[model samples]
Target: MTTVMCMKLACMTECTRQGIACMLTRTVPYATVPSFQKQDLNRTMDLGLAEDHFSRPVGSFVASDIEQLKLAIEECKKLILELPEHSERQKDTVVKLIHLRLKLQELKDPEEDEPNLRILLEHRFSKEKSKSVKQTCDKCSTIIWGLIQTWYTCTGCYYRCHSKCMNLITKPCVRSKVSHQSEYELSICPEIGLDRQDYRCAECRTPISLRGVPSEARQCDYTGQYYCSTCHWNDTAIVPARVIHNWEFEPRKVCRSSMRYLALMLSRPVLRLKEINPLLFNFVEELVEIRKLRQDILLMKPYFITCKEAMEARLLLQLQDRQHFVENDDMYSLQDLIDISSGRLSCSLTEIHTTFAKHIKLDCERCQAKGFVCELCKEGDILFPFDSHTSVCHDCSAVFHRDCYYDNSTTCPRCARMTERKQDDISDVKEA
Candidate 1:
């Protein structure tokens, strides 16, 4: 009863198969003009690159080029069906784009399985009772927005995909296959609901503002889960995870990944608050105050990041022997660092911009020498060790043995600051 009309110049072939016929012979209605018309698909008839990309791998694209590649991939996928069957290199280009996209995705996230890495969203919908209702076809990622659209979403991972896409999924889903609500409780208490400005879509890291009301957007069956509709559909996995919301910083946008990472870091007893840089500490401290101010300073889009974040993610992705970028670097939202040398977060950031390990010292050199060399460490007294011939430097107000000072050098170690001040004074006098 159905037909797949192949408009070939040689054969003018027609195949009467149910699904194949629907793909080829289906007519777009007048009402659904631009969004889902069969005729409108021809807009991608000219989707060809100047240079061949079959040989190029996605890994070859550096961090700076990955953004453009992602855009190109989206465009190329749109062109696959629209390109004429006889179009030169169209099929080949799409194949190469698919290959590159997969490779790039793997390279972008090398560590496919990370312990701390959390899933932002999942397909939380149940299977449909019948196929009578129309919905977006998953294989093509196109949906017909009607008064009512029906679809099947895996309750386990929250993947609401078309039946075709679901059947074609080769792997058993990267996300968890089951929801263990009893085991993993809501770590952070969620709001009565969420607003667009208040919550970020876990998958895309964008605000969850659907039209004006945030609740128009969907949420998981679980108590604390919330994400934009875009993240909900795009997600292929369902990792039972909790969200971290900052009630204090309600208005200023912060990535949900950042919130999750912060929660992850808080769970880490190894990292001490003292070990963090003052600036980082200030950022954490300022988080509570940011809500008071009425401005959005953060770049909210996770996929589209600033140059600094792009470079950081690029360096992280190029690692030689890591399953994935460590310490939520793959999230690319927050910069959580640990001293590789000290192997701990006990060190403090001494310099504004320097190697985290080098600039960050566990303790001052004087504190390190405590008990071993400085007997007066933490005593607020001075040490004197020379056969009862103790002396004190008036300039430094410190008691020391006469031998501690260089021969005829009146200043002690503590008085070096005064000596510099004096030298600076002399220099200023001469200059003046």
Candidate 2:
């Protein structure tokens, strides 16, 4: 049977060599198992014939024709087989190359009947150009593309930035309770070349923008005034004279507008009363004289009598005259007079006597009764024996019983001191 098959194969090879088209077809009944079996056999035979044709060398095959693709596939298969057994990746690469070659062959042939490759290429190129034409971010000279939903752009440069970078350039989104409008305000960032010439509060160092100010308003706590809210409230130079007098004398009535004029005039370093309103010019001149006299008194005497203190003295004198009180009367002590003179205590003698009667304790050293407890410990049981002026920390107020090393120590657990030298060093490092 092997000898017979060899003879038949040789005859078929000779026939194919002679340039005769070999026609090997078999017919069978449609409703028979032999028909399906014959179809399968024919398919296997056709595949064998195709494989035999592709097994030829490239030079032997017809070049510049569709038949060259069959030769290329054979060459790819041979190259894959020549690679090392473990080189599966190389085999796949060769397979892809074969597929690309087949595609190129399809693209070259007009009679092959396929879509025009030039049109597809043009369409793809145009799409890419349109996508890449827009401006992109260059963060440290790196281009970022696409319409990032959460990103924002710089108004000047049109460079796309992350939300956080945009926020750094702009102000924080603070919600206002009174104003229902949603405002998008940008804060000036000096680092990013935004305007930063606006003034800030000297005490708190908070930025003061001019946008919120009314046109008539010239003075502000945060801006050129350089005074924070707390500092402004405590400023004696700018406070109205009526307010100052009211703090010293409770029962007196004063003109508000006149007091404001006086405060404004006093705040100036150099002033002439003639330049002000003519009606109050004489009063202003008198006030200037009184201020000079008070200054002379303070210079000559050890005790300081401020404007508030003088006002309190005037009120006391008025009260003394009204009540027909005698100077050396045994009805009241010097301590009682001092308390009334301060204007902090109630003027009513009965109330003053009652308050002192409950809290006063006799000092052991002076043998005198005192109402004030120790300014440091605030223990009413022990009276402060020392009469010297003392300053203490607000937290503990722990005054030394006697002069000691701890009294000189300003370092506290609550509030630590930061020197100008340390702040200067920090600023230098930040600049560097």
Candidate 3:
């Protein structure tokens, strides 16, 4: 158990060590611990003794054990400060420190600490563009010198600002609830007026004037809100409203907020194309093709899941990026619709379908064993739900040759056998 725990910790350390070190250097300020204590903790960890005891369930920890863990965590933090920044040893130490802290927290309040259940919507800030690219801070309305000045850009809302100004800004990240709900603003460029916005930039509140030779006020094609050049760099994006209402794929100018919000919702399978516009499938050839492929993928999902060989091979990884294809047949993402219009998604789905088909039909005997035999002909030939010529009974979901079912004119042999057995049992029960 000790060796196994050590190995698991080593694996985790290797994976997240670099990220932890980088985060520490960028964000966390240093505080030093005693030298003797740091040395003792490092020696304990190296010997795998810490893993053996601390790796047990948090509920097993007594008060003394918890206090020891707290001290060990402080020692680990001190060790991290002593080591050089971004070094492999420093990264490894950071990982251990994080694990110790988490263990302590869980031991303190196992029942109350449920981080996963909380809904905390906040900015996911990251450096934007290249260091050479010129950009402005959305918070202070000042130029962020990319070559020297430290700045952050919210990946959620594209809210660019100085690193210091990031926490000071009161504006929350703009995330549309469109994915959680089916309703969307279906109108195209629903502009009220700059007067409605008080003639100021919608994001940064910069004053706008249209009296010049060319208007400084830039109108976002997605939200119809006007913004200054800094807040809206005329970044082109496919508008969800336009795509849903008109099946338009033309990229239009959008503000940073709309750009980031649309990006957050890119792969979410919220757009029920059939419910919104069933005629779209008929009008667009690729949409029709994609829908068929998605349906086939859904059919093949059950076969792959039950087969051991298919699981080992990860046959479903073919549709890894487009997992929503396997999830539901009717739902489509904004990106999926956009790609379908561009003639890319159908070809990709065709390739993925071919791979999935190969595994379920030809490659694995275990998967093939799950196929259904035609009850009508009593033949050895196997029929699958996804097969083009096969027909499935609506009531019992039994598969058979389409011609054989048509010949019987809606009577399924399997359903008839069950009915006969049920009647025989009923008659026997009455006699008894």
Candidate 4:
């Protein structure tokens, strides 16, 4: 009638009392009724495995080795049986026994086999191949995240594990591990590292321990910022393995390249880049390219003479009454270039700049009409764009800040009211 775990403990207890010649249960017995499932952190109890599948403490301490484990388990159980129900030690003893039993079973069969882990470690140590970095094994929950192959997560359930941990997994296995092509591409986001000692996980609300290492958080490169590891993993567009990948592809270059004219977009009601004037974009791109070409030419001057420059130097400088012609040419002045401007590509650099400046001024006026900037601080854009809180003077048709007018107000500064009043007084005096 004794439980199988109890019998194992009883036998170990008798080992020290060998002088008493105690007869112990020889065969490991199974219970007809199963043990109650213990609740996990996720609150789901695993009930697939049967009780007594391995030797464990029914209600005792278990240590690293079998002998010490047996002794500790037996002692705890004895105290539990003798102590009062309300004994504080009794509850702890029960919890300790549960932990030890789980540990005992764990040593018997690891979640990942030795061969798999060894190969994974070997792959990690291999040189020359570019691989995503990692430090923890979510499967074992024992190994840190480093030196593992690319993580594999269930497409259906999001159960993640080491690449080596997959073969041991059964069906539900759809396709094989994507060792090469399926490497996750990280999103355009930031991996924020924090130095603070105390903080809670933005997802779980659990306090993050900063015992030895810097705390890690994910940040959105665009709008909303900051996410804890868990929230960053599950909810964020960028995955951990992909975070490093996308950073090189986006942000530093793409933001400025593709979105170089982002400021122009603010004027549009829809706020889309596609709607921007093509002439403006083309002109900007060409200007940048031309500038780059000029720099290259300057850089190569010591090594090679460019054809256009060589022609200009040898023919034009030598022949065209050169100094006088250069002095008379108004190629440098924007207005003169615009007056003489013709074909699209034939436009002089000065003319191109003139048109670009005009476009910007129009866009600025449009933005101002949309309340993007304050008329009172019309020159604020010389520093940074300011928001509008406009107040208009009806008498003089001038606009300024609502706050400024209230702060110091009642008269329109530009109306010349006082001067007009003096003029009226002089006229009245002459009439008298």
Model 1 pairs whose backbones collide: 111-323, 122-158, 123-157, 123-158, 123-159, 124-158, 136-143
Backbone clashes, each candidate: 7, 0, 0, 12
98-131: candidate 3 lDDT, tens digit per residue: 5666556556534332222111246667654455
139, model 3: CA deviation in Å? 3.7
Worst 10 residues of 1 by lDDT: 291-300
Assess each prediction's global lDDT (C-alpha) against the native: 0.36, 0.31, 0.70, 0.34
Model 2: per-residue lDDT, tens digit, 151-192?
A: 333322233432223323322111221123321111111121
lDDT of 1: 0.36
Q: Each candidate's TM vs. the true structure?
A: 0.20, 0.13, 0.64, 0.21
- Candidate 1 TM-score, true structure as reference: 0.20
Candidate 4 residue-wise lDDT, 113-187, digit = tens: 333222232122112122323333333443322222334444322344555555544323212323222222223
Report the C-alpha lDDT of model 1 over 218-332, residue by residue, as the tens digit. Answer: 4543324466654344232122222222212222222222233233332222322233322433444332222111011111112113235334545224222221223222121
lDDT sort, best first:
3, 1, 4, 2
Model 4 regions more than 4 Å off = 1-87, 110-136, 139-166, 169-432
Candidate that scores best on lDDT = 3
Higher-TM-score candidate among 2 and 3? 3
After superposition on all CA atoms, what RMSD does each candidate show versus the true structure?
22.7, 34.4, 18.2, 26.0
